[model samples]
Target: MRILLIEDDPRLNEALCCALRQEGYEVDACLNGQEGLYYMETGTADLVLLDRMLPGLSGEELLQTRRKAGDTTPVLMLTAMGTLADRVTGLDLGADDYLVKPFAMEELMARIRSLSRRGGGFHVDSGELAWGDLTLAELSCQLRGPGGECTLSRRECGLLCALLRHPRQTLGRSQLLLSVWGPDTEVEDGNLDNYIFFLRKRLKSLNSRAAIQTVRGVGYRLTMQSEDSL
Candidate 1:
């Protein structure tokens, strides 16, 4: 699973990132609410770990903005404010769960699992995400089609998931980069191009009807059109 972590304290942020990574999750760590919001708006993270007190934009303001924009990615608010009213306010503002500071990692993991099972994030019940005849198994990163099935690397899986979520709609390069590689990563345009090439090869190998079409200077889209049309 991919998680966006927003914590201002340098030590806590680093520790959380390490722990989350050790748990086998892809994590994007941000020091402030503004950066966190930038990542959240990419519609990529499966979960968000938001700190209530942030440097630039407060966590409450960020959460409110996200909810107002209709982003349903599950948020677990982490804060030092342990009062009942604080918890109530966080929940009322759209947090799916609340964790007071100095909490155990075990409890945090438990809450994450619960939120994932509750299906508020990027999770799907069938363990598969489908577009046209293509179906990708989340756990194994396996892409199956009429011809056969092939396992994809983590990055490939992330890229394809973003496309499948909005099939046929153009996804900008920057959006794809942020979503797949984690926000604010310094990935090159050629890197994305290479991945696109790899994905096309996988589709061709499967003899799938779907294709990833490039939009010249714009970006790319998933389509069920013949290659000749491109």
Candidate 2:
């Protein structure tokens, strides 16, 4: 999943970004609240790690603005304020969860997993996503169909999951890139093509009727073959 981290301390911000990246998550980090607000407005991040204290705009203000605007993206407030009133205020301001400063990375990761599974736009109970006859085990990166099943690499699973989530709608290349690789990642355009090719092969191996159709000079969309084509 992609995460947006808004923290003012350069050291803490850098450390958190590195740790999140090492854990295989796409992370976009900013040192202040204004920039953080811009990143959140882009709607690229699946989860947010927001610091309560920030310059220009406070985390509480940012969260309040996002929530007021009806953005339901899950946010985990990271702050040094550990008092009960502080925790209640943050939660009341619309944070999905709160984490105080000097936290263990293990605990942070656990919270991220919980929030991602809870609000990452997938089927929470089943841990699976489906479109047409194709079913994807999100946790295992396994793709299953009427014909067969195959394990997908994490990247491939992410690419396919994005498509399955919005079947039949053309998604721009840039959008797909931001979805799979964070906005900060320096990935080549060809890398996306390679993953698309890999996903196509995975679908074919399962003999599924689904297809990832390219939209000439635009992007790609997922479609299912008609019975006559089968």
Question: Model 1: how far is 98 from its true place, Å?
Answer: 0.4
Q: Which residue ranges in model 2 land beyond 4 Å of their true spot?
A: 1-48, 51-53, 56-113, 116-123
Candidate 1 clashing pairs, residues 3+ apart or interchain:
none
C-alpha displacement of 187 in model 1, angstroms? 40
Q: Against the unseen true structure, what C-alpha lDDT does each candidate score?
A: 0.84, 0.84
TM-score of each: 0.54, 0.57
Lowest lDDT sum, 10 consecutive residues, model 1, at 177-186
Best candidate (score: TM-score): 2
Residues 69-106, model 1: lDDT tens digits: 99999999999999999999999999999999877554
- Backbone collision tally, model 1: 0
Q: Candidate 1: global Cα-lDDT? A: 0.84
**Model 2's lDDT to the true fold?**
0.84
* Tens-place lDDT digits, model 2, residues 129-164: 888889998778889998889999877877887788
